[model samples]
Target chain A: MDKWYVGVDIGGTTIKLGFVTEAGEIVTKWEIPTDTNNGGRNITIHIGQAIKSKCSELNESYDRLQAIGVGAPGFIEMKTGFIYQAVNIGWKDFALKDELEKETGLQVTVDNDANIAALGEMWKGAGDGAADLLCVTLGTGVGGGLVTNGQILHGVNGMAGEIGHLTSIPEGGAPCNCGKTGCLETIASATGIARLAKEAIDKNPQTTLANKAEVTSKEVFEAAAEGDEVALEVVDEVCFHLGLALANIANTVNPAKIVIGGGVSKAGDHLLNPLAREFNRFALGRVASGAEFKIASLGNDAGIIGGAWLAKQG
Target chain B: MDKWYVGVDIGGTTIKLGFVTEAGEIVTKWEIPTDTNNGGRNITIHIGQAIKSKCSELNESYDRLQAIGVGAPGFIEMKTGFIYQAVNIGWKDFALKDELEKETGLQVTVDNDANIAALGEMWKGAGDGAADLLCVTLGTGVGGGLVTNGQILHGVNGMAGEIGHLTSIPEGGAPCNCGKTGCLETIASATGIARLAKEAIDKNPQTTLANKAEVTSKEVFEAAAEGDEVALEVVDEVCFHLGLALANIANTVNPAKIVIGGGVSKAGDHLLNPLAREFNRFALGRVASGAEFKIASLGNDAGIIGGAWLAKQG
Candidate 1:
């Protein structure tokens, strides 16, 4: 009899589910549209029903599911598995673990979504089983997950890997959404990259980017790849801060791997090459020798896979 | 019938020893001059003979000794207990653990001096037994040790807590001994404070600090306490860099406590008050709320006490 685990990744738009085997195999995976009406009350019920349907389709008994692990985007109480706040999902002070457990009659575990993504990479993706790794996601806002000794460092308040908020310029830089000025997120996120391109184009009327009404992160990378001076400068500034931030973390944690993910990372070697060069310039020589950089491989499936890792750990 | 652990803190000029009971009691302690002649070959023998003599003085046989733990100021190989380098002691690639074990006929463990100091503080000093803490030593240079889940974070290559090497200014900052420029140590260390004071006084000849023959970190703090303009500016600058460095680390690790140690910490509230203010200003509000700042209480005994902790763990 093969035991199974249900890994769920709850997002604002949709919920991803995975029926994972003990050996880290995903026998089946699917998604359901998130029902956020009425404070997300129907979210857990939808997930429960989806899990049952998946088990039936696979011709496996639901009893084969030993546990359910969930990855939710918010501050989570480690002991109670409560979602302190998930602004995207309209959840606050919700006992998500208890709700899912009651609805499905199964034990449940929950953790922050970013942390689970890092664990997913470590378990079956780019980390390649490295126990110490740092996973950085560069989307609308930068997010980070630090794994030490094969476990997530949740810190005292689940704010351990808030690398996005690190003060890069330290003086008179851009303002941040967190009510702080000169935060790394102000310059290195996807939104930050587009903002930088727009600012540069606005200052100089000759830039090719000026022809477009609005610039996106993808357009910025593309313009840089095509040797647009404005876009190149933006990429350089972004990589400079990203490198400094990564070096700071490397000096602190000496992680074996630094994995970059999310939309900005789609720039690929254009982002990684300069970032690695900058990282080498800032990182202590010994720490640099032990660490290597890689692009994240698990894309959207990272959350569910990381949830599986949590289930296995629980 | 009581068993005891022998803790040794090896320094360039002297060695500190402690005979500790299993219950974390230091029954007796002593110091011995270190003989670095002949490549420091006789230092371990002296430690072994001293431990034996101490046991005889207390009317107890060496058979009562459970294990020996050593705190050496160098990069140590955790598994083999090798001292990769101790420039002060002229030791390189030395099998310190094997030598001590062979000489004393007991199991032995070795760790970095700063790490042992942090362990000492956590076990019996200001950490108050908190499992997650970051201890920073501000001396000739800055040294840091991070304890998480009640154990040291050794990282992949034993360089996890190299916080001093983090690029603080990230641009044109002071040069460090590690062949890097603008590191946190170049601005936040005791030496850095003295240097900053000298530079500031040189630039403004009318300041009170300009009259001093030599500006030390202590003099700068004293002048700041008395409201000296140049000294106050220097203090602010040092605290600014120190606070930013700490906040960056706090954002990364979110340790429950940040413990300051070493000589510069003697300035007390003069350094801490400003540092706490800057740290809170930069730290994520949630992390700042959960983390507290404290001065290390163990002083010089921290090394030997931490060594005893390692012995107990072993």
Candidate 2:
């Protein structure tokens, strides 16, 4: 390789790996299904093989290779190369970097998946040219990352961007999977949207939604598009909570812009317009003018692109 | 002629001046009464005279002095150096830096009081060596500063660190001077403490505090220490709100440490222990573990020292 690096985005269902160049561009990328029941070490070996298979296809005697960068979920101890309890992977104190290195013999640098994805989004996506950026992933759960002064900030033990767990309502409300009530994720993520829809269905059984088998947020959105009252109610609540939570996040970060991505954000202006109105109402009037709320553009490609950008920095 | 900087800390009642060196130490400092009603130009002349008078006493040449750094209570419009709105001084768009330069023949840099104080504390006080720090000034009006990777964050329009205005309650709990209702400042600041004490006195007029002509937080703390039930109850409410506010802040910044200063911090363990306990209940598990709360070590001197430190950085 004249000059090349690798970027890995590990999620619950699939692990996306990319071969990238030095200018924050993705040359090639591939995805592999993740089977965590095979154990963490086996997963690392598979990821290494995926990287090697892609690098070999470049078809040149490599002069040198830059470092490989990884975006991981859960608490990644940057110094120890350990994953301290990744919930989706069912891993605790997992020797992630060591296992990957043992299989591929390449030095690895890992960070919280959201942090690197934010870097990717900032360098190439909606946050481009912004110095202060906050990127939030509205997936099965809410993931957050903060970038200030052109650098990712991780508190000691890599727990800096835990905005999902921020208390949205201190009193009794929806139960979060994190074993906490009143968490922001309990009210705004894809899972949270599904929960809100399910609750509405249970509370109002006469709605057309009850006639359908197996409720999904997508179906709810589709119903709302067709003018179903219950679905519209569910979406309005989601936007309301999301708006308040965004306002709170704005208060704290005062970032130039906030980028929202993942499955739920696909609701588009139906979700965004109300959220903008609410965030403005709650955000301090002085700094409220600075923050721009936008739906994240990269979608599924954010991981590879973010990885490529981070790898360039590496 | 060695490196010399004049550090000015302007408050409602006094303007503190210091000669600071490049090593972040205040060699000598003095305080003079400030006349806010006399206009910005008069204040500028008073500061210059204070600096010149100090130089004459030490037989130090005024020509050796570098630029001045001012920590004022308000919004600063960058190098133009106008006071956008110093509520304490009733100033709005006053050209403070230009006035001072013309009067004293020296260049100047100006910033909000809380931001400058945080810089001072970070340079030499409780937050020394902290890569991520959030300082909350617990005064008549609560204010804050955010430093990530050793840089002060000033959001668009220089209003980034308005933590005091973050809504703790959704609406209509108590009114704030900023025209907001149920803000964190309404329940957790020194003015808040006085209000809480006043409420207690109204409820339990038979208590010893009722005899006092003018009640203050200091008197309430004294009464509580003397085993007054109403005083203790009011204090407990303050602690609870303070904890919830800090927990919310912890979720946002995820700082390595939170330095509590200004007058109310003097309550020490009497307030800190309860606040920490309540904060634990509200903060996310991972983030709460990453940060420690501590009383600001620089105490009353944080403002002066912080201004001095900013001068050195300049």
Maximum-DockQ candidate: 1
Q: Among all windows of ten consecutive residues in candidate 1 chain A, which has the lowest summed lDDT?
A: A205-214
Residue-by-residue lDDT tens digits, candidate 1, B71-99: 99878898799988888998888899999
lDDT of 1 at B41: 83
Predicted candidate 2 versus true structure: per-residue lDDT over B1-314, tens digit per residue: 46777878898888888887777677788899888775544788889888898899998999868878888987788657788778777677899888888888988788888887887778788887676788988888788888776777775457666778777777667888877677778877888888878888888888888999987777777787788888888777877777776777677677777888888888787777777888898887877887778778866566677666665666
Where does candidate 2 stray beyond 4 Å? A1-5, A21-23, A33-56, A79-108, A222-229, B1-6, B21-23, B33-53, B59-68, B77-109, B197-211
lDDT of 2 at B248: 70
Off by over 4 Å in 1: none
Q: Which digits, one per residue and each the tens of the lDDT, describe model 2 over residues A22-114?
A: 766677778998778855556888887777666678763333456677888877787656998887877788988787778777777777788
TM-score of candidate 1 versus the correct structure, residues matched by position: 0.97
What is the Å distance of residue A143 in model 2 from its true position?
1.8
Task: Evaluate residue B189 in candidate 1 and report its C-alpha lDDT on the 0 to 100 scale.
Answer: 86
lDDT of 1 by residue, A32-68 (tens): 9988888888899999899988888888888999898
